[model samples]
Target: MDLAARSPAYEGLAIELAVEDEGWHDAGLGDLEAFARRFVEAAARRAGVPDDVETELSVTLTGDAAVQALNAEWRNKDRPTNVLSFPIRQLQPGERPGPLLGDLVLARETVEREAAAEDKRFADHAGHLLVHGMLHLLGHDHIDDETADAMEALEIEALADLGIADPYADAPEHL
Candidate 1:
């Protein structure tokens, strides 16, 4: 999608979207602006973001090659991942957030494969990943078992608000 198609604001949240993969259209994810705006707002609300705080987020929908390149450059991993979150600033506990939240990059092929493997709708799975990435931008992490559980719980709650099923439910050990 073009920059002009990016959503300017939603409940004080501004989203900049880049659709670099035509596969997103081929996969039938029609009009991601509204979908993304709604999910991000839901996540911010669940994360206790105040109404007055304005935030900015960028999302890129691309193929595995682009994501793989990013992964190799940023994280030193040469393989592609489902989603990548790059938070502009990591907030401290009880710290107020800044205007620029971060960016999210999603790989269409990997996301689609994972969704099919998990028996989830593509839209729902993508929403889950968006929520997961948003939480990361909001200073949540799954670095350890305790933190992982906490983050997972938060994800479940946020997804619940969106009428999405618990992504961890009825899943394989690896998912």
Candidate 2:
């Protein structure tokens, strides 16, 4: 599937996609951009943002070490999580020409491991995580059960729109 034509909802959002991993040669650039765009568009829609509204978003795919450092520096965690979102809040509504949504960081190893554990394809799992992270960037969080439920529901619907199966369908033993 061509990433450019997949999501009509994010036609105006400017996405900066970066692949920081040497091991990610197997994944196509267009495929990654498509997944990231899908996630961003879905999250924005859920947040009531206009599809045509200009927004700037960045996504980076990297190995465990880079993500681990980001996790430690920003979240105060010693190890890398599956993904991390850093939303840019300093941009004023009128002062900024367009919204700088924020940044998303994904860990390659953790993503692969989770995909395998869930008995799903790596690309699908990556898409799910990207959506989850984008939601967080848009100020959606799971701090409480009610919020978690709402967020998860949105995630399910978003992933489904991408033809990905419900990521939470078969709960892992750890859950």
Candidate 3:
């Protein structure tokens, strides 16, 4: 069965956490609910989500099977990715967000594998992913070189604020 938690706004954003896979509960991540709240809220602030918008969003921690299904249905990938963001509506940068933002779904196995491969602490990697997903929910994309650079910069700044190492530090610089 899924375990869920919902609390009042954290600086104008209400974040709900739902653990859909037992592995998440057993992952020894230390308070996934609080982690999600803190990272997403910080991301919203960093991405200029507007403190007065009174937004709401959900994060689901699940396994690859579920994520694969979602990916196939929504994105037609037929594979499990680390995280997926499903936004209620796409907003332009600087556009005021709304009461309902979007949902972020993460796969536990994929996240763990990625963390181990990248030599990152699981929590730090997950936190970075949360920030990335939050940016996507706010309509930030890396579709073009310029936009990718801007989004990556915002992600680095946001993750730094949360005390996470820059996820793209080792990535080759854009030409």
Candidate 4:
């Protein structure tokens, strides 16, 4: 993946983006990289990070098997998830050096499956996952009702900017 163009928020940040493809065999690599970068930019803006914040991040697009293993190892879940974020560490006070935000791993198969099940476009779902992962990189979580609501609202707004409809608006009744 090529990351020649970066988000304005990462202008002065000594950031290195490494994109890895694990044989997903669906979408083109360029599209995936662009989508990942867009997600990072949106998330950075939402987190109130200045364009000059020195941050480094990486993204990996993998198949279900790889993600399933990761989910099992890290999250203790047997099944593959749409996305997983691994943040490195938080910077302490007066730590003026750049921070490594860590990696985002996305499952191509899971993303497609969820998109189909939710009656949404695959690209839109992928975009949402990217944004979701980026938020995680920024230390956001939705383990509770209130946090979930706020996170979902932010996701909706972010998706809207990409001309996507609210993903949770027409959730299945059973859910």
Top model by lDDT, which number? 3
Report the poorest 10 consecutive residues by lDDT, candidate 2. Answer: 90-99
Error of 4 at 5 (Å): 16
User: Which residue window of length 10 is worst by lDDT in model 3?
Assistant: 1-10
Model 1 pairs in collision: none
Q: What's the lDDT for residue 150 in model 2?
A: 77
In angstroms, give how far residue 157 of model 4 lies from its true place.
1.5
Give per-candidate clash totals: 0, 0, 0, 2
Encode model 2's per-residue lDDT on 1-175: one tens digit a residue.
9977675765778989899996665754357776678777765666557666777888999989999998889879989788988888633212322568788888889988988977888888787888888777776777787777777888888877767788888864211
Which pairs of residues collide in candidate 2?
A: none
lDDT of 3 by residue, 1-175 (tens): 3334543335678788899998887777778888898888778788887566688899999999999999999998999999999999998877777888899999999999988987888988888889889999988888899899988888899888978888887756421
Residue pairs clashing in model 3 are: none
Global lDDT of model 2: 0.76
TM per candidate = 0.89, 0.84, 0.90, 0.80
Sorted on TM-score, best first, the list reads 3, 1, 2, 4
lDDT against the true structure, per candidate, is 0.84, 0.76, 0.85, 0.71
lDDT of 1 by residue, 122-154 (tens): 999998888888888888888887878888888
